[model samples]
Structures are given as C-alpha cells and as structure tokens.
Target: MNNQDIKAKETTKDSKYIQQHLANERTFLAWIRTAISIIGVGFLVTNLHFTMRSTLSPLGNQLATLIGLVSVAVGIVTIILSAAVYVKKIKDINNQTFRPPVISMIFLGVFIIIISLIFGAYFFII
Candidate 1:
C-alpha cells in the first residue's frame, strides 16, 4: 500500500477508535454540564439554608448545612478532576493510548455515596 493509503487507514472516519474519541469528547462535555448543575445545587442549598432553618428541626438544619458544604466541596473536587481527565483523555487519544487510571470512577463512587448519605440522613431525621 502507498503512504497515502496507510495514512488514510490510520485515521479512518469509520474506525471504532476515532468514534470512541469523539464519544469521549461528548461525554466530557456532558460531565461539565453536570458539574455546573452540581455547583448550582450547592449554591441553592447553602442559600436556602437561611430560609429553611426556622422550619427544620435542629438536626435537620445541621444536616442541610452539611449537605450544602459537602455538595460544594464535591462539586469543586469533581470539576477539577474532570477537567484533568478530559485533557488527559484527549492526549491519550492522540497518542492512541486511551486508558484511564480509574481514579475518576472511584471518586464518582465516593460522590454518590456522599449524596446517598445526605439523603439518608435527611430521611432518618425527618
């Protein structure tokens, strides 16, 4: 095969590898939107804390505060890591070495656990 043919094959449009890279980019953008929503939730919760404090029991009030703080913290943390992952993933794709270290997934698991805990606390207390 000619060099042109090899070059074309290396980065073919129909290649699964190319499709996966595109998919990753789309997923990264989706994650960014999710992070923004999370930050918004954090902001709302923290601000709403003042308005709801009078209606909530003592434990409920505290739980709300904890959830607010944790939500913001987790949102910030995930935002940083997600950006890093997205950049690294792009680099990996360019180098044809698209493997993740799995740290982000682990972090995601932890974030889910935190959210679950927050809800569980609210339910148990109320």
Candidate 2:
C-alpha cells in the first residue's frame, strides 16, 4: 500500500478514541488555565503590596511578599502535577485502564485549605 493508505489507516485507528482524546485535551487545557490564574493572583498580591508599601507595616509587607511567593510556587507545582496527570491519563486512556485521580486531588484540597487559612489570618490577625 501507498504512504497515504498507511496514514489513513493510522488515522482511522486513532479516530476510534478521538472523543476520549479530545476530552483529555480539554481537561489539560483547563488545568493550564487554572495554573495561569493562580500565578496571576500571586503577581497581583505582590504588586498590590508593593504599591501600598507606605501604608502597610513592615510585618504586613513581609507577609504579603511571602504569600505572593508561596502562591506563585503553588501555581508552578500545579502546572507540573497537572501535566504529569495528563500524561498518565493519556496513557491509561489508550490502554483502556483509566483510574480516578486521588492523590493529586487530596494534595490540592490541602493546599487550598492552607492557603485559605493563611489569607484568613492575614486579613483578620495581621
């Protein structure tokens, strides 16, 4: 058979799971968007702190900077973890052995809780 025929065959094979693959891609993109948003929030917090430095006490300024840096780091971790999950899901999908994500979800939940507590303390106690 010609190259075109072989290419067509491969496409047809992959097309069998096109919907699943598309869904996976959409999920990955969503994760990417979430990461970007988290990063943006981090930068916004840092910038706000810098802009209002004169009004904020030294301790408050330091706390804001720390929170901003932590936010950025969390965002970076989210991206890395999401990419790993995406790749694993892709492989599982192809192999027809997909499993629900557990560890990552738990990790994220804990992170959110910690961050929320930090924000609450910063707002109420600081």
Candidate 3:
C-alpha cells in the first residue's frame, strides 16, 4: 500500500474503535468527579469538628478528624488507582483484551457503605 493508503486504513481502524475510547474517557471523568466529591466531603467533615466543637464532645471531634483524614486519604488513593485503571483499560482496548470492571465497583460500594456508617455514627451516636 502507498503511504496515504496506509494512513487511511489506520484512520478507519481508529474510527471503528472510537466508541470504546469515548467510553473509557467518560469513565475516567466520572472517577475524577467521584474523587473530588470525596475530598470535598472530607474537608466538610474535618471543618465541622472545629465549627461545632462546643456542642461536640472531645472524643467526637477526634473521631470526626480521624474519619475526615481517612476519607481524604481514600480519595487520593482513588484518584491514583483510577488513573492507573484508565491507562490499563485504554491499553486493553487497543489490544482487544478488555475485561469487565467488577472489582473496582465492589470496592466502591463497600467504601460508600462504610463511609455512610461513619457519618451515621457521627450524627446519631456521637
């Protein structure tokens, strides 16, 4: 094939794979949004301890700070891991070996549940 013909063929191949690439981009953006939200919540929780210290017991403030730090840490970890996963998914798509994303979803669900329990305890028990 001539150079122009080879370039046209490659473009066609890429066009056929565009949908998967777009889906990967969307997933990456969603993960970014999730990470930002988690970090924001962490900041809110952390500040609440200081703002409402008079009403909260000392132990309550401590618990809030701890939870906030953990949340922030998890958010950072999520961003790092998501970036890695995004890269892996793109590579897999290019190689036609993409796998279902089950483990990350399960981990996210459990993380949300645990965070919910922490917030419930903070509001009701502490």
Off by over 4 Å in 2: 1-3, 11-13
Q: What TM-score would each prediction reach against the true structure?
A: 0.68, 0.86, 0.85
> How many clashes show up in model 3?
0
User: Which 10 successive residues of model 3 have the least lDDT summed?
Assistant: 7-16
- Writing each residue's lDDT as its tens digit, candidate 2 over 80-103 gives 988998888878888889988798
* Candidate 1 CA-lDDT value: 0.75
Looking at candidate 1, the ten consecutive residues that score lowest on lDDT are 11-20
Better of 1 and 2 by lDDT: 2
TM-score quality measure for candidate 2: 0.86
Task: After superposing candidate 3 on the true structure, give the runs of residues whose Cα lies further than 4 Å from its correct spot.
Answer: 1-9, 12-15
Model 1 lDDT per residue over 12-56, tens place: 433546776778779878878887888788678657766765666
Distance from true position, residue 121, model 1, in Å? Answer: 1.1
